[model samples]
Target: MRIETLGINHSAQEFLAEQNITKLYPPQADAVKAGLLEGQNILVAAPTASGKTLIAMLAMMEFLSTKQGKIVYLTPLRALASEKFSEFKKMEKLDFGRRIKAAISTGDFDSVDKESENADIVVLTNEKMDSLIRHGAEWVDKIGLVIADEVHLIGDKDRGPTLEVVLTKLKELPAKPQIVGLSATITNSNELAEWLGCKLVSSDWRPVPLAEGVFDGGTILWNNGDSDEIESSIRGPPIDLCLDTIKKGGQSLVFAETRTRSASLAAKGSDAVFKFLSDSEKKYLEEISQKILDNNEHTDLIKTLSSLLKKGVGFHHAGLNQNCREIVETEFRNGKIKLLASTPTLAAGVNLPARRVIISSIVRYDVKAGANKPISILEYKQLCGRAGRPQYDKFGEAIIVGNANSSDLTEYYINGTPEPIESQLADDKALRIHILSHIVSNPGIKGEEILGFFQKTLAGLQIRKNTLSFSIEIAKKFLLRENLIVQKAERFAATEFGKKVSMLYIDPITAIYFKRGLEAVSENNAHTFGFLHLVSSCEEFFPKFSLRNKDYETLSTLIENKSSELIEPISEYDCNRSLLALHSWISESSEIHLSDNLGIESGDMHRMVETADWLVYCLYELAKLAERADLLEELSTLRKRISYGIKQELVELVQIRGIGRVRARKLYDHGIRTVSDLQQIPVNKLAEIDKIGPTIADNIKSQLKKVR
Candidate 1:
């Protein structure tokens, strides 16, 4: 179990010792004994905080010591990618005597990442890695190893197919690099290992013991047939449990089923939490609370979160901005926060563990089902794994708030096996997008070879052969009907349009929407609202806006006025609301203004704007392919306007460095509407405008001089 006994270099051993990781856990030792250091493919399915990360690091380090190829580490989330990137960067400081450059690529989908190609270790999200492969990054074939973190997400509906297909594609490479899949303990680890042709290492070993139980009527009955009496100091069960944990001088993580519940529980528990904070701690928490509210408009949600933070409690969910989330996570990790309430997003993978984990409810609202549904055992296990932090608690506690269905919960989650991870690649939409990507990227692949390629996938292995073939054929036919794929005798090929769509990293359905919308446009009917409606109607940018009764009159009026120019008739209220939001956004409305008027949060508004901008750029690219000269100029103008959230007249000025939507509007108001106007103005006079500083003015002048 010693680090030096695993065939790792001495420098790597020293690095591991510095990290206090000189001894390996049982599962890690099992992996090493199975020839992991000899470049064997491995699938390690173990409990959380069981040294899985270090096991993968050992393989990567040993491989890099003798090989001259890149180590591509793929994660499921951008936050996890960033965490791994920072960890790998520390290898550069080790005495390895080589430059170990590390790079990360996640959300920058449109850019050609040439830097990651030359890196010794590259960290990327699964989607980013798939896009890079579709764009045919030359370095992919030279990858020596791929470490798939959170590999159990292969069962996820939205993201699993991408991870499954990426692994299949990598396996097909001529180099045949080793793969290390790190996953939570699932029921079918051996099946997954057989699919990947790797050895399996499955264990339930935890560095810190986990005690799971159900709490009902001020008493928690442990799974070991023992019980503890919890004195309630708060009204709700969640706060009561939180107060119990805090009384024992341990931090607690409360998992709620929704964002609203998370915030409400945190606020309710803050009263009891405040009793534990010292004056100095209260002052520090106030400073952190101010940091969360700095430079942001005071919305109701921000106010609630800030108030909770003052009592050393915070809530986390997708609604908060990334900066606020980072601050809360750092504070909680530093042991400053007593109780942190959050939705299941933190359970996905962020390394924020605590001494106690309280599950407020096991049921979540299923949007598709239109009812509250119980969570899967895999998900419950993921949440429970956050209870024990290595190097922290001796034994972590996971307490579920019990109700009438407490027995079912205990039988299903506490004493149950995790479900087998089934491949979601069988979904039609997933297959359509990835099939086009594969054919477009590999021109030599023929129609006959398509099904053969898929047969190597987990989906192909799980489903019946005939069922898999039928699904593939259906997807292929759909792609051909949409003109994304063409068939000539026995060969299948991607059209020029299909190649562009694949490289653009958009759904094939989005491309079809653009094509139909562009074909219906005439020179006179082209307008900003028409194009905005087109992009918003696509599948990629949907679930656009929820229409309230009060806003229906306004949205209906806008839809009626633009009825003639819209590509698709605005029949749904949500569609109309989407157009109105985009219209306001491009009209240079502030985020706070949109939040107040449209009932959208700042995070939701930002996501909508980003998706719209990317779709507009795709529409512009499609216009070029369609050879519609009339639509080209309008699309270009709209693209720029959407990119900067500005009016059409401000597009040119917004393109200049140091000039944003606000500055462009200010210049326009002052009768300096164009670059020529900027060139003629003195720097000192330009600095006199509101919010424009002298340095920005100088930079604008410098950019204008270069333009001239």
Candidate 2:
């Protein structure tokens, strides 16, 4: 079907199609033809960049034109949300038979300006959506359609709970907006469809036929038409095999097992391609090269990325600061990047179209095994799904490039079926906090009232109503028995202490620990960091040493030595593992193989870092829960430090608008510091600082007036 056939299809679709997408894939056509006009739920499962987003936008535009409501496009990643926001803003017109506003609300610190209430369309992340609902964002009522782009993220443990709860909450919304779930092809689309209570529309037809292959040594082994047996047939050289694919003129995405490893490969691979650029490009590249001497991670990343740029290559991993990652991704998507070395998280849900995807290493490190294990079937499929861009490549090539053991990669890719999406609705701290909020909010509303709410959850939908009712009753009893809430006769209101607990946004168990600390411990570093680390490591924390798990002794010795490497452990569910992994990964170089001892892999260690990041954020929020405005301000400043890992003006802008740590430090260095600096410096000089907008500048000046 012609993309133009959709009555509300924007010119952007035309622009995208003009670039390559002239026709819709069968699944996309099926979606448009499925009478989506009636506002029904539709699940679309196809390869990445296979016009799924176009289909979503078409459906959204149609709803906006014909229906009297708003559209909410939800993404798993804030970056993706921002990208799509920019993409959709290019539309010429959007009429909802009324005032139409289009905006992005991922609820980042910058999203303070977002006005979701008036938007005809709002692009945001699932977490932002959850926050809006939790905070009672009033505009949620106008929502008419919701597109869960990358709905498959429902399996993500850290984030999946929020998405599931958000969707369940949406289902309970009085309006019950239409649901559109988009994902790459997975093994269990039918089950996901049922879970979502939507009609299943699954297809594997890529606009580009994806050719499977394996590169052994220097030879590129073509798919002999038997994808089923390719694993056994091909054995190749290590990194060189993938280089062969790139030399053949096909841009390749190489999925590495670890971030440091990805950076290492991109550094080498890019140098191989660096001489291809013009002199001006080379000069710009040289600037990036020189900048790596700076202490900033972003600078180091740019240096790493410059190698890719010289050779049309890029590397992406969570460890790269957000700003650097965005630069690499944007450049790569523009086809300026011929090769991208990335970690598996990229496979989770970022839509960067690639001509071919090479599984450079199938052995991903597992933290538990403390060694490189084969990648999961589900993850391999997700990575391979990136192989073809529906509009660009005539046929996408997915090659598992390896040394002589290429058979392992082939075996996994060929026979690998995507894993079943597991329900991670475990006894999570986040979930506990949410449940408590529900109880407190409804007040006096008990048993069936609360059970009704739970039943609407993905867990409730998957389980029987009676089972949920029983579970809710048990949870309620557990809460009361534990004093998370108190019931009096026929009414219930959170006790004054309970209200404070809710305000703190912590799990009841964590709150109990805090209360215990308040009684038994002084306000000191050992008390604070120890309790924080313990709470953060709720998933697992080995007992403090008895010979088994000898790493415990290392952890203790480091703690005892007051090692500068140990920062304040963030208080969150995953912080413990994260801190340990980070210390291990970054600690003194060791020949003593961690794989043999801890059985943890580098990828698993990387994941711990990511999880620790989120934990740090949660801890920051907890620290901010206090009513002390000064302390909260300090906490915000520290958060900025974490976000940028620098004392730059941008970090300062985030810390406290109009002035950031850099400018503040400059003032400090100059012996002209604090709010008093603004009182002393010329307004123009203040404005010279990064991210200091006019409003902020004016505010700073006003603040100085009060200080004076």
The prediction achieving the highest TM-score against the true structure is: 1
Q: Which stretches of candidate 1 lie over 4 Å from their true place?
A: 561-565, 572-578
lDDT of the structure predicted as candidate 2? 0.61
Residue-by-residue lDDT tens digits, candidate 2, 207-254: 777677766655555556443322221322333544554555656688
Estimate every model's Cα lDDT from 0 to 1: 0.86, 0.61
Best by lDDT: 1
Return the number of clashes found in candidate 2.
Answer: 20
TM-score of each: 0.96, 0.76
The parts of candidate 2 lying over 4 Å away from their true place are 3-22, 95-99, 108-114, 215-238, 275-308, 368-371, 402-412, 426-431, 461-478, 488-508, 518-658, 681-708
Clashes of each: 0, 20
**Candidate 1 per-residue lDDT over residues 612-646, each given as its tens digit:** 88888888888889998778788888878877888
- Per-candidate RMSD vs. true structure? 2.0, 7.1
